[model samples]
Target: MPNSANLGHKKKVFDLFAQKVLVVVGKGGTGRTTVARVLAELGTKTGRRVAVIAGTSGTHFLAKEDPLLSFSSLEPGQVLISYLYEHGLGQLGKRLSSTGLASIISTAIPGIADLLVLAKIKQMERSDAADLIIFDAPASGHFLRLIATPKGLADIAAAGPLRKQSREVLEMLDDPTRLGVAFVTIAEETPVKESIETMKQLKKSSGIVPCALFINSVLPSIPGNEKVQDLSFLESTSPYYQAAKYMRTRSQSQKHYEAMAAKAFGLKPIEVPLVPTVELSEDDITYLADIVELQIRSKK
Candidate 1:
């Protein structure tokens, strides 16, 4: 739970984590990973044990070089193998998925992999390791597949032990008090469109409305630039004029899409500024986290 004193009006933002899980979703390249990182840091700031679980492709955001042990990859292969170990297949678990046949078989199974994927997150929630878990979910399309696994499994294995397990996971997922979904997107067309589409499907299939929407990489307004229009006098061929003019036009365009995205999601989108760095450093991520910290307070 968020420490109210620490939040100091930031309660609503950070308090969402008290629910146990937040799965970050959006189209690829929309900075979902960055949003996850910011949220994780916020969790820690509010004095909760936070863990960032990323899909396979998102693992690199947490490097060995980084000292945070609170980050991990939600690889399905590892999930199945670990389940075996937990269920008394200890020795077999070690060598089972190591085999070529086992790898292909798990992949070939229709919903088995997705089952383990959700199961793994549920497993983390069930454990004592962390009180707050942030899943930097896979891309929108794949995330939809992952979210549907439990219900699909329930329909097929209605009476077996598999069905029982599915029921337990579904209970957690279906209960918004236990799990929350958040979308990460930019103020661009494709990502916002995909996000809205996914948001609709997510609500229809999972019965969970997103807890929040984060619009990443928004341009910060330069002084006197937000309203600037007639810059043709500086010489249209000049790179300086072109850059300023482009920024002005693009910034305005982003504001339009930002408003549309917020309206479509029916939630105010938290805007994160674009960083002027080649690669994000810890300082950069911290800066972003600080910016996002405002969202919590404002909403509170």
Candidate 2:
């Protein structure tokens, strides 16, 4: 029998995994892919089967590094084709794939491609393909459009298979137990501003709030009891002193943005330290994952 404490810990872990889909969203260059990969790594490391459905290209590289991870990218065109066949419209699917009709249809119906992708994700969830599925969604504007697709269609599509499918996807999006959004951003002016605004837009449009916020690439504070202002005293023409001064100033700026985000989101943002490397390796990802896991576990 599990002890009460152990049971509580398991419950916490289960709660995190219970949300079958985690959509990682942020501004472009805000490290959304890295955060998504970290979440995938955390799930697999915890012994849960995981899949990553990347909205952008080159993400399969993560899966290549981790044998336990499953990665796939959804091409809107292909997803539309597969969706038709799944509904017993095989001939139509083939015709569209071969001809320009697909483009015409996609262009004619706004959000059709995004809706189809959501449908595909919904299908994956129902099939239990993995214990957790991390969707590395497109950046701000695109992500807003993506999640809003189902609701948009449900309103316009009044009474048919289209309506039914749209409603179903909307249900998945609204169910907190089934879907979670992790918003990632760097502690810079534009990204921070965009992050808060996008999250508010997400809530207003979809009625789904983000489950977590991550401030990526945060610089560590300079050691010692010296105040931030005192760091200026060490300013010199030497490259080493210049580098130190730059880091201190940036670190101070990061703190200010982090606080601003925390206040707006009403949730303490998880700060991911900047890894001192040009290109992050698999081990760096794992190290970051461990930090996130530890923080989450501690919270529990």
Candidate 3:
């Protein structure tokens, strides 16, 4: 139901939520967290139960007053305790997780911490605790490792409980109808190139391509740069003309990279306008969410 002629050419993100898990990823500093937060806000506003999880502190980004959202940070010890408490081992969970041995054990398991992150997310979705889980997964390199963990375990553990658990996590991660990646990138040489390669590695590893590509912080084309340029006398002397020309040049560069990404990844990148500010409030986040929401809403 997404409306943009550009977005209409690809899968609407709202449709992807029906599968329940969205992993937002990109190179560091590409606003992956920003994208995850906006997606959570928009999903909550649209009446779905939403959870936002990150490896860092939850209080760092989420507003507690919002009842529609549940936020959590990924911590192995806490997850182990929570898992134990759920299965009627509350006293044992608390005592063991409180000790240093729990940390040491988690470290010993190659990807236990990250796999628990996925396990917790899928459990929340399956239990109907949330209609959608937006995961602010680590940047590209680590994300690939996280998804590959279960498979690696499956390859090693031929049989028994660990094998069974690994298979379950593997199925959940590869369930494209539900779990998918959203690649966020800025319009620049390195990020654009990295995005292309990341998408390739993701598909190669999990057999799932990106569900969406958000070209964040795009500068708009300066209005009537051509007309202004036509005034030959103003071209040299006018600051207005120079600024317009600069903007036009930059906008074109963005367009070129955008095109390259589309051709390489076969996704129509959603061009989110640059919000020129150092700091953002809840209202600003909502405003940005509105921009994204416009792309995925039903045409009806």
Candidate 4:
């Protein structure tokens, strides 16, 4: 879609994460999870300790396999219900219940206590035990809310433990050395346009700019040759011929969109080809990894 050359000319965002944390975000179905998973695998391969966490349902696909990368899903413990049950009821239950009324209630509801403890364990597993945590976050619309939660909660709990927790999350967001966000998009009008808007909102709301823009499902340039011209001449031959022409035209349009987006963002777009099937096999992931390695090497 956009100009590959224009994207190629910009600085690589991976340079920013030489020894830091990175978070990938994008609209749904833009392959943000795949890119995040690949990055986690790459980090582990390079001898960096890596952990991948997902705040949405689709992220479970990444954890299904025995990852060369360490992985966890955050959805289980991210909700208000889960948070209250876990940290409030379970982990802090006995202590809070040390106050007679709380103790009597917690003791009475054994089922509630188990649920709370399980949730706390899950939350800690998602957030605390990672060297490089790759958060396969919720889609763009929900991501803004997710990032804003800390500040909102902090304002409400200015002098409590919740305030301290909020401060820690805020510090993670503000520390460039500790956290960075990546926005994945396709070389299409809707996704690219939304990605730009997401980046703007992220900066305005959280003071965090997306460090990278990944353009997925790029069509490689068709080689120039006499045969290609002959194929073009056959555009009116049949419906099949017309379909081929339409495909080429779409590719060209996508390239233009990608180039324009790159120029607007002042960042290089990481291009990933559109594979035919929806599900990617391990071999496919490995192939993609090779392409990523080349892109990174070229930057070096």
Which candidate wins on lDDT?
A: 2
Error of 2 at 283 (Å): 1.0
Least accurate 10 contiguous residues by lDDT in model 1: 1-10
Minimum summed lDDT over a 10-residue window in model 3 is located at 1-10
Off by over 4 Å in 1: 1-15, 62-69, 81-108, 148-150, 156-160, 230-233
Clashing pairs in 2: none
On residues 1-300, what C-alpha lDDT tens digit does candidate 1 reach at each position? 111112122223435555898888877788888888888877777677788888764356833333333887876666665655666777665655444544664655555555667777888889988878888876736546657445675764465455766777788888877888888889888878877887887777767778888888888776666434566567777887777778878777777777777777777568888998988888887888887887666655
Q: Encode model 4's per-residue lDDT on 1-300: one tens digit a residue.
A: 222455555465555354356767788888888888777766766666676767665454544354446766655223433455544465665565334543454344322222332233334434646556677776735446446444553554465454555555566667667667777888888887877776777677777766777778876655442134466556566775665566678777787778877776777766776766768876766677677666666655
- Ranked by lDDT, the better of candidates 2 and 3 is 2
TM-scores, all models, native as reference = 0.83, 0.84, 0.81, 0.76
List, residue by residue over 1-300, the lDDT tens digit for candidate 2.
000111122222223576999888887788888888888888888788889888765554455455668889975666765666677877665645533655676667756666777777888999968889888885537546768554566754565577777778889998989998888999888888988887888788778878888889877666642353455556566665777668767776777788788778766577677888988888888888887776566655
CA lDDT, every model vs. true structure: 0.71, 0.73, 0.71, 0.62
lDDT of 2 at 293: 73
lDDT measured at residue 69 in model 2 versus the true structure, 0 to 100: 81
lDDT score, candidate 3: 0.71
What CA RMSD would candidate 2 show?
6.1
Q: Candidates sorted by TM-score, descending order?
A: 2, 1, 3, 4
